[model samples]
Target: MTFQLAACAEMLWRDRPIDWRASRLKELGFGVGLWNWPAHDIAALERTGATFTIMNGYLQGRLADDEGADMLLKSARETAAVGKRLGVHRLNLHGTGLGDGGIPVWQHDKVTGPMWLKARDTLNRICDLAEELGVTYTLENLNLMEHPGCPFNTTADVLTLVSSVNRPQLRMNLDLYHTQIGEGDVIRWCQKCLPWIGEVQVADNPGRNEPGTGEMNYPAIAKALKAMGYSGPVGLESNAEGDPEVALQAFRNAFTV
Candidate 1:
């Protein structure tokens, strides 16, 4: 079976306008993925008529404190409005706010018991908001090297949080790129995260470029996903190694099991 293929417009065609990138992805028969919504032309994006699979769910927030939780809920509510306006399928979130260079705004050297409890509570509240808004939100995993000190940034940590909550409105973004960097057992992680996965994102390790440009064997990974019955959205959240179209075609080829 073929997966629902999409590409992060923000990562590709950087020299082009955002709408132009979205339009090109659409014309190429792929859905679009976005980053922060405020940086783009909403009207122009709407005109493109691309199927927006997912985008950042919050502008600024954290998941492990009262003050951060409040900020998270407020930001999520505001972003949900934009998500609904664009008819985006899923809204994505991280453990906390990421700053310049993808570093966590709030850093934690070690997560404590109370922090874990608070993070789960905050996610439950996020689910409540999602149910109210008639939208789904995904908690994404980030690697330590790129996003040091970020809490709940591991695949295991993200899975634990989402599974503990066990709500449909909240699910795992299941980014294999980060998992490959942090934890090498990609197929096993896929099996563990299968039930609660909202979407599966991909980029090769060592370079953060399209599938074949690095160490990960994406075609094998794709076949594994099909075997596990995860025929959901698979997004190429990678930069083009060369031509954007060529990179996207490589992504499509990898997942076309």
Candidate 2:
């Protein structure tokens, strides 16, 4: 199966108009990942005739209380509605962590367990909302150092969460950079959890920049993905060191059709 290349909108935010960014993606024969893009921007993107492959909905740990959880759920549902309207099918999300002057949400602390359970329940609600909105909800694995409070830092953790949730709409958003940084065995881990994968993001190790500009062997990684019959977008969720066009060229050269 052939996979689509996608540019993360955050990369070109400083240098290009949103329409121009879409045009560049079209020129490269790619899609786009709308990272925390506002709902109002959907029309502008629609005008470019580019597909929004991934939509990210905001979530923080400070909102785990009943009132906060309710608000977060509402926001997630609304975001999913917006995503569906924009023709986006997958929504990526991060786990909530502990707030200031308190125990972390995913740690061994007493508050952590309850908070995690509540968050898990909230995620299930979000998944239900996603289905209602005609979208898939994917939980992303964060780098251990980057997200110390997150309980899920490994593919195993992600698999465990999915098993507990047991929902078709709730799946994993596997990010190569975080996997590498977290010391995950990328190929083996991905193979083990292939069935749960809903989306995939790519970047190089150490610097989290465009592939080939860093130490990641993207060709090998691409080979693994193809072997696993992954037919989703290979999202370019990385920073562009020089020009976005240059990053696009590198991605094209690295992956095979």
Candidate 3:
């Protein structure tokens, strides 16, 4: 079986329009991961004959409060609408940012319990919307050091969220970059998190650059996922070490199964 690779559009080809990003990646025989893109540009993306696999929907919001969780639900609804129209199935959202008193939502706090419950409710409702819209809502994990105050940090935490929600439409986006930083042993981590993983994002550890620029063994990571029967697109979500094309070439060479 063949798996796909999606380039993080915003992280590459800075000298062109949003539509051109996909076209350029297509020229390199690559797909794209969408973020901060307008729904109007979907036609332009389609014109490039590009493949769009995952889109970042909501980045920051409180999941525990009624007002905040409502905001997230509304945002997710809008994102699902746009993504469904564009034929994109995966809509990735960060669980939470920071809460009151500048405390992380995933950490011990006064409102953690209530907020967690609310996050659960909000995600479940979003899953309902996503199921109806023929889309999937993937909760993405971030690192504690890099993304301070990020709610979903550990791989286990993200897995717990998906398991707790218990919705077919709700899943996990295992960003290996963050995992490498927060929790090492990516190959084993990938295996453990395989069941709930709906999307995958990659970047080298130590430095958030292309695969070959840092300490990560891209070939091994790729091979591990493939061996586990994961056929979903693995997104290269990092800045180029030098030229984007060269970076892509290195990735292609290293990550091929």
Which has the greatest lDDT? Answer: 1
lDDT of 1 by residue, 110-208 (tens): 999999999999999999999999999999999999999999999999999999999999999999999999998999999999999999999998899
For residues 24-128, what per-residue lDDT tens digits would candidate 2 score against the true structure? 787678887876666346777777877778877643432235665677677777677677777876877765543443234545312356665776787777777
lDDT of each prediction vs. the true structure? 0.95, 0.72, 0.77
Taking all chains together, each candidate's TM-score versus the true structure is: 0.99, 0.86, 0.89
Superpose all Cα atoms of candidate 1 onto the true structure and report the RMSD in Å to 1 decimal: 0.7
TM-score comparison, 1 vs 3, better candidate: 1
Runs with alpha carbons beyond 4 Å of true place in candidate 1: none
Question: For model 3, how does the per-residue alpha-carbon lDDT over 1-257 read when each residue is reduced to its tens digit?
Answer: 25677788878887778788888887888888887455447667767767778886654555656776777777777777767666776888776644453346555313366666877888888787777778887888878786576665578778877889978888888989988888889899889888888888898977788887888998888888888999887888877857888888877776788
Q: What lDDT, from 0 to 1, does candidate 2 have?
A: 0.72
Model 2 scores a TM of 0.86
Candidate 3, overall lDDT? 0.77
The deviation in Å at residue 187 for candidate 2 is 0.5
Best by TM-score: 1
Backbone clash count, each prediction separately: 0, 0, 1
In angstroms, give how far residue 243 of model 3 lies from its true place. Answer: 0.7
Error (Å) of candidate 1 at residue 234 is: 0.2
